[model samples]
Target: MKKYALLILFVFPISRTAWAQSPEVLAIRKYGTQNADKMMREFAAFLAIPNIARDTVNIKKNAAFIMSMMTERGIKNVQLLAPSTAGAPPAVYGEVKVPGATQTLIFYAHYDGQPVNPAQWAPGLEPFKPQLYTGTIDKSGKNIPFPTDGQYNPDWRIYARSASDDKAGVFTILSAYEALTKNGLVPTSNLKFFFEGEEEAGSPHLNQILEKHSALLQSDLWIICDGPVHQTGRKQIVFGVRGDAHMDLTVYGPKRPLHSGHYGNWAPNPALLLAKLLASMKDDEGRVTIKGFYDDVTPLTASEKKAMQEVPSVEAQMKRELGLSTVETTGAVLNEAISVPSLNINGMQSGNVGKMASNQIPTFATAVLDLRLVLGNDWQRQQQKVVDHIKAQGYHVIDHEPTDDERAQYGKLIKVIPGEDGYNAQRTPMDLPIAQRVIKAVQTTTTDPLVLQPTSGGSLPLYLFKKYLNANTMTVPIANHDNNQHAENENIRLGNLFDGLETMTAVMRMK
Candidate 1:
């Protein structure tokens, strides 16, 4: 019996060695490294196109570019779902079906990005010109831009629009697929790719598209290639993503701008009114004051608590990177802070926001509020609560959609235009057999301890695939945590990008 046990232990690593010794996998790792420059150049071309949301013209061009790449790579059945008023920029869809495969995997990613304020870009760094950069800029302190000419440095990375948030992720996924199929490393499961064009704009028509193409979108599992890896550079296999929602509210007073000196004491100040109204939503301690806001927040289960405890101390890391003295909320760290719901004022505008300060009271003030919802919270209902709360505060609410007569008379009245619809949070069970296979495969690829985040602070439309298709969805982000996803100076580390390709290759080949 002792000899039997010894033999079993000896065979374990030998068995793994047999599987890991594939020439295809080794060539993929080698090619990913060797072709790093070529890959960056291709990415630079993709980044050169201004693929911001709402720009249907450029959106289609970008989609066409993706389709063209897939076709050039010999991918079969590539097609573009043309844009319409219902949805902007057609979604890029394609598939590779391997005969005798028992399972199918659907890969999801976004091809669109947030609008960039060109003036915010650094000198010699236009949003369309993808140059490499390093060093950090403190927006509050100083906006200094460091330059790097596409070389790997411990402190520097490639800087460009969509470099990290998602474009890098898409590149990684495609490269992995290319490396596999190119070298005859066929995936064990049938693979399908779905690249959407409206994720940055809240995925308003995604549900409709999903419903329309239920047969084509069906899969055993859906893998979202978005977001960023752990700050420590550990490979992560996330089980879920937190849901999100945004609401724009405004306070109006006199029909037009008023002279501050003339009505200093008597006239109502919309700006001041907006500030006071915003202050009412959250307390001094950062707790939200909305009625029943916390009542429906799903409680963290024992498993989720275990996962949270396993997450590295994000507080110290955040403070060190963000140059913050301390974190907010009751917890001492940022990850803990994310365990609850949050209300943030994303943007506010009323009067002049330029160098010249006009001494006139603005007639209207608008505030864009974003609410990050946790599990067990419904997005639509929660959005309604925000509207109710504003009304409860005794101010007349002006939603974006006005009555026809009101639109004709007011001729562009001060109103709220809902920026983006909210996404519902979702979490998948970690104990599932397929999930276990993925976790084990990731462990085989890297020595870093796997960080299993129960849910991320960022938003993704995971609920749709989970609820509509009954598919198990997971996120595998390739970008570094400090990639500055939505802000200026966005970038992705070449090392991280390479590692992502290796990990993705391993995931695809996992049986």
Candidate 2:
């Protein structure tokens, strides 16, 4: 039989109370142990498929695979939920109903993953090929062979795209129901599973899909299974998620590239100009300096503030692990910082570097800006603020590239292109009765205190669920914090994957 690590040994000891988990919970673990060999093979094969939202062919394959799993595990009415737009990636839907259960929960997780750059991944890993490692690759961990016996080390990790970011969520939710039924533990609440295929693309079609299927998707709650657990390895229940928007800004220089030595210091460099403009958007303390950036923020409620107070401080530990002696916010902690809006430059480009080095001055500088919005912050309004700030800084902001006449007329010219798919932030009340039940359901799986967060720093289109379906949502994330989400060499720890089985099982059986 396989031995599973219930909790990290160094993080928190198992409480006498947690160790006395009910018989149903114990049965769930046993099922995972006794079936690790067969389950691991199925999961590994699923991870081998490429699931980019724009790759229609491969994305459809993923949906078909999920439907097969649902059917084999006893889900009813499994189908692809399509939007009005043709060829858009669809959501896979299925459900399990109980005889007299009045309450229903729609479990949500995205099956799609962000696009990957193969060269950026570490030498030992590839985005599509799933590989096992003894520990984190960054910690001098070595690759290991998959065991043939029904045994796995909780410390081992599986590296692949979507392994943690959400496929783990889809796998866990489906397997949780399997555990319950195979062992004779019936769920108390009706269960539904929704696997979205376009979430990483900002969920551009989600609103339409929800509007088209309002009646079919009705539920008392939407338990989101994305993001990561607490950095301390404790489970977390998030009440809200930040909204997301992107801006593409370009600064114009010369009409053509100029030799640096021939016109050195004579011609203005757009790269320098762009850097200065970005630097002015924030202070040394990291607060966005744009006027009215914080003016629209909503203060936390008394209950929210009290819940925040109880959250364990992870700043010091985070800094030590991240190798930083200073944080951008002077006095605010991590939880307090995420409560407000933020601006970040995801990437910048001006001229070639390294082996592509050249002595010519580039004709333009471009940057991709990411804006994270908290409650009361509209994605459109937040983007406009940045545009307005640029105008106030003596530059002429245009939606199109500057013409020769306009370029000569204005000393500073920039083209500001805004994203069309941006959405605002959403938060469900922490005091809601359903929220309390979600908290308790996840708590039965661990001895450590469950982290109750007001809002996660990550951005999801969860607000659309509220806007289109008139329903509230909460989050129960299962990935390890260092899962390298949306980046290269992404992976999920074996223990987090196993623990998630019990957590979702408890939620499915919640009263």
Best by TM-score: 2
Model 2 lDDT per residue over 1-511, tens place: 1244422231222212244267776788778777777777888888999999999999999999999999999999999999999999999999989999999999999999999999999997989999999888989879988887566767778999999988999999998899999999888899889999999999999998999999999999999999999888888999999999999999999999999999879888999999999999999999899999999988899998998998889999999999999999888999989888999999999999999989988899999999999999999999999999999999999999788899999999999999999998989999999889888888888767899999999989888889889899999998899999999999998878878898999998887
The 0-to-1 C-alpha lDDT of every candidate, in the order given, reads: 0.74, 0.89
| Predicted candidate 1 versus true structure: per-residue lDDT over 1-511, tens digit per residue | 4333422332222112232434555577656544545676787788888878788788888888898888877778899764334655667888988888988888888988888877887665677677655444433223233322322333346677888867776778888888887677778888888898888888877777777777788888888889888877677878877789887777765667888899887777878888988898888777889898888988887887898888877667677777888545754366777767788899998889678779888887888889888888888777877777766776655765445566446422445555457788898887778888888766766655788888888889889887667788988877888777788877776567776787887778777
TM-score of each: 0.87, 0.96
**Candidate 1 ranges with C-alpha deviation above 4 Å:** 1-26, 82-87, 134-156, 400-420
Model 1: lDDT to the true structure: 0.74
| Model 1: lDDT of residue 303 | 82
Residue 354 shift from truth in candidate 1, angstroms:
6.3
Clash pairs, candidate 1, are none
